[model samples]
Target: MNATTPEDRPFGTVLVANRGEIALRVVRTCREMGIRTVVVHSTADRDSAAVLAADEAVQIGPAAPKRSYLYPPAIVEVALRTGAEAVHPGYGFLAEDPDFAEICARNGLVFVGPRPEVMARLGDKAAARRLMAETGLPVPQGSARPLTDARDLAAVAREIGLPLIIKAVAGGGGRGMSVVWQADQLLPAFRATRAAAGAVFADDRVYAERFLPGARHIEVQVLADDHGNIIHLGARDCSVQRRYQKLIEESPAPALAPGVLGRLTGAAVAGARSVGYSGAGTFEFVVDGDDVAFIEVNCRIQVEHPVTEMVTGVDLVREQLQVAAGRPLSLGQDDVRPRGVAVECRVNVEDADRDFLPCPGVLTEFVPPGGPFVRVDTHGYPGWRVPAEYDSLVAKVIAWAPDRRQALARMDRALAEFRVSGPGVRTTRDLLREVLADPDFRAAEHTTSLLAELTARRSRPHRAG
Candidate 1:
């Protein structure tokens, strides 16, 4: 069967159900394509860049995410009232909410992502692990079903061995995860993990998995249209993270073990096709000792997508719009080629010196870096107040070059040139610079635990810089 063109299935108006940089990114693409955008914002974001740049802006609710972004009813109502043909949930909030996607469908609006069922299957961490295992992909030794009781949880923990990890079955980003290094820590970790999971995802279901220490966090960028055309751009190294939340990402993952990179990317494309996925998605994995284990799937565009875009020269947002419009992909598998190296550092309003504590305040001076091969994506201005209610991310600084060394050098210069500050408002600029200069990071030998281990060492009196 042939796929329809954009003209045959047009979504002229899209309601952006997100905030901050991602919303602005979507609006920018919509403007380029001559598609109107309706930005729904909370009271705190009335003056946000996205709201100001949008074709139309609507005050959805208060600053609390539950009332504004996460509130599906308000978002769906806004789309219908504004006559929006589709809703684009960028990255976080309701991006992977299966019920929210279903509501969009019921309201005669395109969800601008995979089907609700697909989201349900891929968004659930446990379910995704099972699906990947079923597809003959490598998944860590873990429980495929939710633990029913404390005894059941302990049994699974014992089965997976002592140094296993407890994770929330419903969500990720280390929101509800704990490392149990011994038998004594199992129950407490399980309880804490469940409590955290319930608080974040409204589900207390927890599972256990073999924890691989010093692993590299890598993921493949996948694009699949409704026409069954699936292609992988490449892999990204997201190993530099704090608390499992990615802080830096680079495309063409540096120093991948022999055959490991090809296998991971191939399995990612195959996984997407087997699940009948659509639009942009990411297949996340943890590489340990020449083995890659499937972790979870991000059902929407990722925060670090700019790295892939810089390297591939593909407008992922544009491809997503076309896919949602029922059009065939503009490029085939052979056309998806990556060139150059790209690195992205997430700039957040945190005091890295004070252990990365969140320090939000009005920005007194905000000067982003520029020049060749440098891109800064932000929703902040000189006097904009950095709100304390949301994620700490203030901007994303990206740099590209012909090779990884040059890319890193460019990113270092860009970070150095960039300036953002306010009263009691601390940023991670210095920390990123320090990391960039570290020999291990420069050599691509840094793993996910490197940052945490560095932080621990930094606290020691003898190792204080």
Candidate 2:
């Protein structure tokens, strides 16, 4: 790998090709880096914070995501028309889309992520599992390739045993996944997952894997440069989740056996290097006891990035910009140091009691919490209507402290003080508070099934002695 000179500045102007908090998150970093920003929005996001904060804003299309954010050609055209030197697909819309990255490259704009080929390789779940296993990362027992035929799927399921998971090849963000516990449910689950995957990701290919029940969802954050320098920023615990969607994330995953985290981070760096990856990415793993298995790789900035940032004090977006500009990583492994503990909660506009149903409407009043180490990343403001067309995520509240106990306390307090009220607007704030107060969570003994168990216990009727 060759290193570029320090005089080589990153893109002068970047177009954020997503909406909501993530788009605004990118714009904020660009502003601090002295780079001009252009944010493209749909009719629903015309008054979004990202659109308002950007140096320029473009109205791409109507409220429908397909007509706006997910449309690669229109986004590329906007970048060209606005003279944007690069395009930042913040996270969801086209973040993991290799074709979108290729389109940006063909148009001579940096895509602010891994190369298109690398993304295509790692974006597919089956291919990624194969590559990681070859790179010496432990993978769960399952089919080595995608299971497209019904007979093949059943055979693999029989081999892997019952209670396995069927996942989409192009799945991410917990979307295109199903768990099969009985033999009778195998074929139906596979066909359903395949159909949903095709409808969502345009790729119906499906794969099966041995599901690790009660495992901790741990992920290592890695940063690499064009110069072949790869380093892990440490690990994050995202075990508190419902329906496979993470609600809370914390850094320096608690209560791990000695050297477990070290091995996880080391393997993550090795896997990233194996693929010649460059940019900010995450290597997710499923950990049960001391054993860990590589799950999948997210080849873009993640939603839980703020918790890692809070502990490492590294601006991942800035690192991404520098690496995208063909520059070497500013800091090496020896220079990287992590301090303190941090926790982040995804404050979504949903009713947790009602099975997490989306409750979107105009925000009548919005007041985010603030303090010494509390950081709130949000795009909502009074009178801003939450669009039901997209994700329910409205804000990410993060808190940092010297220890996990203090961090949890700070997070609880921050959530308590957060004031968001509107017509038909509901948040997961109360449920998050309850999770933080759980004894298992406080002791870091929780697993990926914690949320489900918690909800089940709450709903169970008490019997009279």
Candidate 2: minimum summed lDDT over ten consecutive residues — where?
1-10
Off by over 4 Å in 1: 1-9, 462-465
Task: State the number of backbone clashes in model 2.
Answer: 0
Model 1 residue 50 CA deviation (Å) reads 0.5
The best candidate in terms of lDDT:
2
**TM of each candidate vs. truth:** 0.97, 0.97
Tell me the tens digit of each residue's lDDT in model 1 across 316-338: 99999889989888899799789
Question: Could you list the CA RMSD of all candidates, in the order they appear?
Answer: 3.0, 3.0
Whole-model lDDT per candidate: 0.91, 0.92
Report clashes for each candidate as comma-separated counts: 0, 0
Q: What does candidate 1 score on TM?
A: 0.97
